[model samples]
Target: ETRHLTPQERVARGKAARADVPRSSHAEFVPPPKRTDPVEIIERQSATRVPELVPIRYSRMSEAPFRFYRGAASIMAADLAETPRSGFRVQCCGDAHMLNFRLLASPERRLMFDLNDFDETLPGPWEWDVKRLSASLVIAGRANGFDDAERARIVSSTVRSYREAMIRFAGTGNLDVWYAKIDADLLESLLASRLHGTKRGQKNLTRAMAKARTRDSLQAFDKLTETVDGRPRIAADPPLLVPAGDLLPDVERSALERQFRGLVERYGRTLASDRRTLLADYRLADVARKVVGVGSVGTRCWIFLLLGRDDQDPLFLQAKEADVSVLAAHVGTSRYPNQGERVVSGQRLMQATSDIFLGWERVEGIDGKQRDFYVRQLRDWKGIAMPERMRPRDMQAFGQLCGVTLARAHARSGDRIAIAAYLGGGDSFDRALTTFAEAYADQNERDHQALIDAVRAGRLPAEELPAA
Candidate 1:
């Protein structure tokens, strides 16, 4: 082309550039539907859309041990993308990470290992719930800086424990399986198994016992309250103690109260009549914003302290925002007609021991608010023994314990007999999962990076973002 163009040539170039351009710079970049229940549109997206989850899976790629775990979760989600599952779908704690399993008081006043988290509860495949739990073990190992080889061995031991437990359960009497539990004595035995003849390993076991001992109700009580005139009031620690966020406008508060009043009646069906009657007498003390978990940062979480007669007889309750399951997007089906019902039902199905006061309600709020939420006791001896807190040998043993626990929980909800047969006479599935976990963890890191990028670009809301 000529360096010095004619006036007509220059005019032509300008005209072409103008023609190619659209009028407006602003445009909407819509996301694909994560869950499409018409009624759930108003619920907080943090309750469902877990982009942080994907990123978490991806973030550990910088290190060698975690390199393999990157997309392990995404792959687990994909492998569980489609499968025929038990028809008896109930609201399940969608991400049943081994850490989420903890010591809690049963109705009989017996302390038992039970699931304590229900933030992402939704109705969906039983397998999806378990696989998510399994992958968590692998990711957790990487987070603690375990090497690939160590992580692989831990994952193997974990799955093996689950498979072996299922086999044992299938052959044993029902009552025996129900009676199966891990107590302090069982934990001691597990430590002995892990320690073998090593003095170093024995020391690790002692340390674990000391750590676990410090995590009882007394420990929780100290942190949960300070004695005020020999009476208990929630400690004023910003949002932690304060159950409600800010004073709701009278119009909004009245609507919330009205909906919650109906909630007691609807909640009755989720439990036995006696407990329902007990909850009916309870009065709401206050409601406040609450943040929970590394993944569910922006969800509309609130704590409501209920008082039956006075403050000492306090019952803490949480109404985490409920949304459709992530698995629903891939499966192409909603497990239940009502999302609130879906959550409540799944909790009943999956949890061997459940909070007596679990229930749900739909409240009408201002600022385009009409949201449904599932409610449950905030803390009932909820304490988790972190994996990193254990020695290598003890970690292996603990992994097995978690596996057995997972299998038992699954057996309760799904066809354990059939699953046992499917896994007969082989460790191939265990090995395959180990491989899958390592490989996919790498993928997760990449996805996490995409999330970090999105956050930096201000593509997502600030509340929705978590510290990487």
Candidate 2:
């Protein structure tokens, strides 16, 4: 077992890391001579996914450089593997792009901002998450037509926020750090001076929070289900949302229900006793295959509709496939053999709180292939930020919020004292990351163009859906 170091020793170790890999070394990003073709990476991932949906993933990514970045985590992971590291590893949200941070309701029904997507979660170098986030800010800023100087300011401020937050966590008590969270009130306070200063800004923020609260299981039931033969069933929206019955016309509905019920019971075993008991109250009413986010597109995802006390009391649980994290190739495979367990464990470790229903199970598909899946409530009070709508100042404030949030997540799993010590009370790390962000953003644009070119040349099939 590794012996725990004293606080002074930890600080010295951090300083020593700085000496071995100078902080400024992070600013560079020269694509290695034999760098793998980014398109090939996407194609390899597509091979394991539902083939029909792979084109949708390519289509979504081809929309813009920022959108492409969202779906290109594997590509960036390869690049990040080549970057300098501080030799510290944490349970990382391997794809820590800006959009992944959002508002989610805690078990208490209190809204809080946190990292939501854990499809790519794994233990890896802390710098990977930080650099991915920084680069995302630059890419999004460029999409918004921000000048170079403005983008640099945004990236620097954000990195500085992360550095400063780590310092705070380093001095805080372990219990306090564990319980720390950015609740709705705290979020308002943080953005009060900038994002909530004007009446319009305040109105927008208030409206969004109020809207998020209404987006629960009941709301999803109303929006995504319809009554058929006096029974509720998940509605179909082809190539995006296809009801199980429609997707498999040959299978009997009763047989499908039996299979899903068995899956649910098995999944419930992974939850706590109380939660398992709670889950037992509902009966599986319907199931649907749904296409989710950009990177997640093509992955096998299913939504289970459960009803209690008549169709009115509904619960939607999403069971998404969990493959090996992109970072696994560079870092190491998760100790948990099941990828779903890796995601669930990483989320529980990195977040102050996670969905109570969060659990994992292995399922044998219709093709007789077993796949690992992590399950969670389909819709709670979830709110996402649209980077395309953000102004320069708004993005800067949002970036700072994301930065502090990422630091807190890292603090929960990594050595806060060591990381804070490495950062010190200077802007060196922040400035270096800002430089790196711009360089990586340039590289991202080139990769984005490459995808578009591939699509045009018929090297990759891309199905363009109408804008939402």
Candidate 3:
């Protein structure tokens, strides 16, 4: 085992990294001569997903450049492989775009702001996540009709927040760093100040928080289920939400339910004894195949409804198929053999807290094929950010929150001292990333247009859904 270095030595090591890979080197983004076609990457990924739902994925991505960026994590993974690195590795949220940062409830029911999606998580260069996030801000800013200067300022401020936060974490104790979190009260105060202390801004924040609290399993039970013969069943909304029974004949459906029950029991074994016992109180009532997110639409996702004592006390659990991380092809395969376990482990490592039901299992589908899945509560005070609806100041404030949250997460798993020392008190890294973000945003627009062209031609099928 390597001996632990002194704090001064660690700082020196970080400074040494800058000589080998200067911080300014991150600004460069020239697509290689042999760069692979972005559309081809999407098609390759689609091969492993549900065939009918692939069109929905394509259609959703075709809506805007920002939307396309959300679904094109694989494409960005390829591009990120070509970027500069600080030689520091962390458990990265591989698709750490602006939208992936959101408000989620902790197990203690305290609201917190943190990275909500870990579908593409892996241990890789920390810069990859920073780049992904910075580029997303530019794309989102463009979507919101912000000018170039304003976009650059927002990206720079966000990157600066990350650098400054990392520096602070570097000076703090290990336990202190691990215990750090951005709770709801802190977020509200930051937002209030960032919004110029306006009453409308405070009111809007209050309304959004109130709305989030009502999005738990009970609320989902009301909106997503209906009483049928004195029993509750998940309502079928075809192409998006389809009941499992509707997908197969009676005989096959019965067998599928049996397999799902066994899978749930096996998954529960992976959780703590207390959580497992708590889960035992609820009995599975129904299962439904649900399409979720822009990139995740084609993946095999299931929502299970479980009843506790009576139909009124319901718990909804989601089991989402976990494929290999997009970063796997470039960085390396995960240490965990099961992809679902890979996701669960990464989430546990990075998040301040995780869902009580978070666990994994491998199940054989009705088609006799086996797949890995990570299970969690279907909904629990989850709130998503709307980038297109954000003003410049609002986006900037949201970006800062994401930056600090990401820094906290990285500090938990990586060399915080070296990373922070490398960043120093200068703004060189922040400005360089701003340049990189703009250049990558241009490249993203071109890629999005390519998808639109493919759909117009006969190359790709796209089914546009009705507006909500």
- Clash number for each model: 29, 0, 0
Which candidate ranks first by lDDT, i.e. highest? 2
Model 3 is weakest, by summed lDDT over 10 consecutive residues, at 1-10
C-alpha lDDT of residue 103 in model 2: 88
Model 2 residue 60 CA deviation (Å) reads 0.6
RMSD of each: 16.8, 1.1, 1.2
Q: What C-alpha lDDT values do all the predictions have?
A: 0.56, 0.92, 0.91
Across 366-390, the per-residue lDDT of candidate 3 in tens digits comes to 6899899999999988988877777
| Candidate rank order under lDDT | 2, 3, 1
Q: Would you list the clashing residue pairs of candidate 3?
A: none
How do all the candidates rank in terms of TM-score, highest first? Answer: 2, 3, 1
Q: Which digits, one per residue and each the tens of the lDDT, describe model 1 over residues 1-468?
A: 321455345334433432332211101112225523211221233334333333332232222323323222233344454333333232446666666676665566445555666545555555455555556666677778788888778878887787788778766655666666665556557657766757766665556455554554344445665565875544555432343324354546566656555655575566678987888787765455565554443446666656677665666677776765545655554556666766777666556667787877776655566677787777655556666565556567767777777777666655455456555547755776676556545545544555445546754333323322
TM-score of each: 0.71, 0.98, 0.98
| Model 1 C-alpha RMSD to native | 16.8
**Candidate 1, which segments miss by more than 4 Å at Cα?**
1-79, 82-93, 118-130, 173-269, 332-335, 461-468
Tens digits of lDDT, candidate 2, 1-468: 111788788888788889988899999899999999999999999999999999999999999998899999999999999999998878899999998898899999899999999999998999999999999999999989999998999999999999999999988888988999999999888887756586665666788788889989999998998999999889999989999999899999999999999999999999999999999999999999999988889999999999988879999999999999999999988899999999999999988899999999999999999999999999889998888887888888889999999999999888888888898999999999999999999999999999999999999999889643
